[model samples]
Target: MKHLFSLLTILFLLSCASKAQNSSKEKKTYKVEKTNAEWKELLSPMAYYVLREAGTERPFTSDLNKNYKKGIYVCAACKTPLYKSEHKYDSGSGWPSFDRAVKGNVELDVDYKIGYARTELKCNTCGGHLGHSFDDGPKTTGKRHCINGVALEFIPKEK
Candidate 1:
């Protein structure tokens, strides 16, 4: 009976330690860091508007929405893989939509711009604004990750 109690205590300690470690590894708030000159040189005006300034792109404007190849979609500002092509789907909203983000990647914040509540998506590492999330999406996840085109860069899978 005493040995069983000791084993239980050991397991409890190990579980607590793991929980603390995992919490520490979670992503935190981030801020953008780039000079205007560098941003201008690296991104077009529209891309800059949406990515750096948190402006929204008009619906159905991104070519990536129609993309069907297998690849990873990355943040255009920080090159962090945000979504997989397998998660992409046609939402007919004029923007690229993903049902989910890459595992252990990306970050989300509560946004209330224009008197409406939304979940703002951003790069976990750089904190660049990606876009908003909505509940109206296809079956499976019921999440519409309405992302701007200029905010992402696609890396097609090698054949």
Candidate 2:
């Protein structure tokens, strides 16, 4: 009985830890940092939900999901260029999908929000949660960088 009790306690703690990690903002130091109030003012409610709270927008709700143009995608909070137009693709995931990120401009962390580990992507400059990455993707890099449109600001390429 003693061993069983200890085991149950450990499992409970582990589950709680994962939940906290999923809901909380990353703790790592970012180059661009701002208080919650500052971030709230600079970002829209939806943007703040997706970027700071690590929330997801409803599928098929983003205008950028079907956008096909020449441009670069930058972090909404900080204008850090993340994905180039050439790398963007239609993964049918309802959110903006990119084959890869601009090298070192985005960061990846493990997320266990749904009881499974998913690769959570973040803006390297400001540490804003962008989205998750999956292994299923085009042959180029075999990386599906599933991103939230609200977390990105598209900048049209200068013609």
Candidate 3:
């Protein structure tokens, strides 16, 4: 009976130790935890409105849309790399347009808001609302991914 008790106690202690070790070794993922007021302070009014509240910036207003430089575009929310410079093109819609997306990066949804049918693009990692895509583009794929400059941060490639 004493030997049986000792074996059970040893097993219980081992189980607890294993659990503690596992928890300690587990990787911790970091998420941005900012209050609305804090976020407003951290970002510009336009960026905060569009990225956090899903507001749309006026068309033909973003300077980045007119940009034709080579660089990688990243998500403004989490800084995750999203689109490539090669994907960019001039669609004359006032927003930065792309023919395709970075592989396995963004989430696309069919948006029917305000009696208009469009494809809404969003950041897959941070869920930041980007903008709508259209079928008018200068590409063989015929996809014009109209993106909001507020939702993206451009990093010009090294010359």
User: Which number leads on TM-score?
Assistant: 2
Model 2 segments more than 4 A misplaced: 1-26
Candidate 2: clashing pairs of residues: none
For 59-157, candidate 2 gives per-residue lDDT tens digits of 899889999899999999999999998999999999999999999999999899999999999999999999999999999999999999999999998
lDDT of 3: 0.82
Clashing pairs in 3: none
Candidate order by TM-score, decreasing, is 2, 1, 3
Relative to the unseen true structure, what is the C-alpha lDDT of residue 44 in candidate 3, on a scale of 0 to 100?
Answer: 85
**Candidate 1 local lDDT, 1-159, one digit each (tens):** 999999999999999999998887464545656777888788889888887788998888788989989999998987888999999999888999999999766788888888988899978867777898899988889999999988999999999
Q: TM-score of each candidate?
A: 0.76, 0.83, 0.72
RMSD of each: 9.6, 6.6, 9.5
The whole-model lDDT of each prediction reads 0.87, 0.95, 0.82
